[model samples]
Target: MVRGEDRHPSLSLHLRARQTAEYRASTAEAERQLRDNDPDARPHRLQHCRGLRESGCNRVLGIINLENFERENAYGESELRLLTTIAASLGTALENARLFDETQHLLKETEQRNAELAIINSVQAALAAELNIQGIYDAVGDKIREIFKNRDMGIRVYDPKTDLIHYAYTYENGKRLSLESEPLGNAGFAAHVLRTRETLVINENMTQAMTKYGSYALPGTQVEKSSVLVPMVAGEQARGIISLSDMEREHAFGDSDVRLLQTLANSMSVALENARLFDETQRLLKETEQRNAELAIINSVQAALAAELNIQGIYDAVGDKIREIFKNRDIGIRVCDPKTGLIHYPYTYENGKRLSLESQPLGQTGFTAHVLRTREALVINENMEQEVAKLGATLVPGSQMERSLIYVPLVAGDQARGLIGLMDMEREHAFSDSDVRLLQTLANSMSVAL
Candidate 1:
């Protein structure tokens, strides 16, 4: 009501009562709706009506209800001035409270931010202390778990040569876990990450997440509620992936969590790259050493072959060097007589002992005969027992028979000259491709010497 109005005091009181009833009804309905929508919603705070204004300003901070002041008559000047003063005092207090609450919130936020910054710095420091992939992975897992309280994480290192994803490191339930490598085509979470080279954030059902990734969740004892898969990329190449998972909390990861993990992944990528380079360098060094050793063996064999020695002397010299080079003691050099059509074992060294096998017909009964007939190198292991039996071949005639054998045809001219056989009765697949090649080279040199 306007001041100094020619209106009845009864009318003014009736109008105020009606307005209060409407406000109560509206407030009750709003609270009911809110409670229905959210079971855990808080009760609505009481709000006062806006009535006071100074200097044409209408910014309402808060209000104080005066409904209990049951005045039947129109308010006089003294009561009006008192109500205005109360309104101004209430507005000032409300403004101060709002400012205080904001300041407290900002302080708490600053503390949280500082704590996160400290964690990042600590992780960076830990990462810096490591120069290898495994060490970096361990540092990341420990630091992240210490700060974020997560215990499940996995690091996969990609080997391009083998095209395999190797689980380099893993932590689960506060314990370090070791894992085996699998082919990249395996249908699992890590495999999918490696194939796609994309970061996957899963906060919902794991089955659905796996389906989205076009695979099933890798078999594990622990169930995961939320997870993140970040691909570790160095330059244009993807080195591996870091999988962060939570077994307990759904929606455990946030935008900030993803960013932190990505940062860790980037740092780990560089470290893995460094480790790969180091490994490659070591491998090259080893290859060079092996090459030098083989070259020296070849030179020694040539020098011995060129000496003015008899057939027995040549066989002894070659047998000694072959044993030294191959590090195998079971060796036999059989020379074939083109006229007699039989193989003659002039040199038979078995575990540093000389055995006498004067001569035998070149029939389909042994590996030497098979090589003499076919003129092809044959490398046989335990798996090739059926093939060896079909060939009806037995070179060494004892308990230490055909565990593994390599028979190379020695050819000097247009026809097969003889056969050189090496056997390993202790191990299967002990000889690699290089071993076969080097032995063939020795067989050729021996053929020429004969």
Candidate 2:
């Protein structure tokens, strides 16, 4: 019961310690006096003339001295009885105080745990924004480590072809594995669990008589004492297996532990599947965007081949094409006429970040002009040295950040309309292939706008 005696915060213990110290000192003084001339009534020698006073206060505990303790000048029966009564009354109060302390401690622990869980939830949500395979795996495994107190956990991605299990990521050894082989192969409990796609529990005694899973487990990877293994399944397909190794405790895991692992695995499975699909979607979107961008460039070139009937028409036609394909609003057609080296023909600005006809020029002044001269499309960081300041021409006072931008040039035989620029406002998010193709095609269309 005194497992945490050193940590006890009882006011009673302090009082008792103080009282015992005082009593020991007094007894020593009494014994020293007894050694002197008066041994029989030594107590009388020291206290014969002392005045005693009693204070009015609610008493709790009572202490009883033995009958023969008078040799030590101890209390009489009445006083002993009173001490007993005090102790009796204080018993219930002490018990209640202990209970209240325990409850308060438990409540504090629960609140701290709740705060930790909230942080984990936020991390998981942030992970959700990522749609990459490795990113998803890292996120899931990281989350598993965190939920399980960031201690011991293992993962083996399913190999449908080889039909074997191997470690995907292990929160073990800081890369200094206790088990052999960096990636655990088909052998011990891991293989057994993964091969069967079944749940395994090694509550206590990790690497023991695991006969049934002998063929399934990692060689010598034994359960040791306590561990839990669960198969990670996604879309009815086994994607991987999660293994948790227990550290120093009886009944290392319980039903709640099992349920929690299963729940996290399920979420991880779904998240992995979603990430893969999103990656594929991104690929598809890229291809489509590339094709559209090419067609737009072609259209711009062809339009330039014709006379500039209505520069606004060319600008609108191409700009609308870009908005439809790339989902961008900052689009404009710039022309390079031997008559006028630079000209900006516009349709409409969007996303509330418009292009200033006065300051921010379209062609080479932006990415489009550079592309026109080199006949190469240009993509640049939206927050470069010069652009950082020029951005103010379009953005609000303290907000100058966009994702990325691209520019394509229109060439008509020997002549070319300066260039066309398109932009979006989510950095590190590059323009899609379809967007490039569409812009190129629109560049082809800008000659007439010139």
Best prediction by lDDT: 1
- What lDDT does candidate 1 reach at residue 276? 65
User: Model 1, range 179-270, lDDT digits (tens) per residue?
Assistant: 67767776667666666778888898887876765665444547688989899888887778877888888998898778767766776566
TM-score of each: 0.46, 0.37
lDDT score of residue 249 within candidate 1: 84
What is the model-wide C-alpha lDDT for candidate 2? 0.55
Residues 1-450 of candidate 2: C-alpha lDDT, one tens digit per residue: 011233222111211212233333333353353347344531221211111111233322222222231234444567546644554455445546766999997885675455446434643564567535555556666766766787678766766666655565665533324334334356666566656778888786444546644533445443345678888777667777877775556577888677667666665666555665676797788767666665665566457447564755555655666666555556655555555554544544545454445323333444444465677776665454466445332432233445676767767776555667676665554666656765666565445434
Show the lowest summed lDDT stretch of 10 residues, model 2: 45-54
TM-score: which candidate is best?
1
TM-score attained by model 1: 0.46
lDDT of 2 at 425: 60
Q: Rate the local accuracy (lDDT) of all candidates.
A: 0.66, 0.55
The runs of at least 3 residues in candidate 1 whose Cα sits more than 4 Å from the true structure, single-residue gaps closed, are 1-230, 234-237, 240-275, 372-376, 383-387, 395-400, 411-416, 426-434, 437-450
Model 2 deviation from the true structure expressed as Cα RMSD, one decimal place: 16.3
Query: What are the candidates' C-alpha RMSDs?
Result: 13.5, 16.3
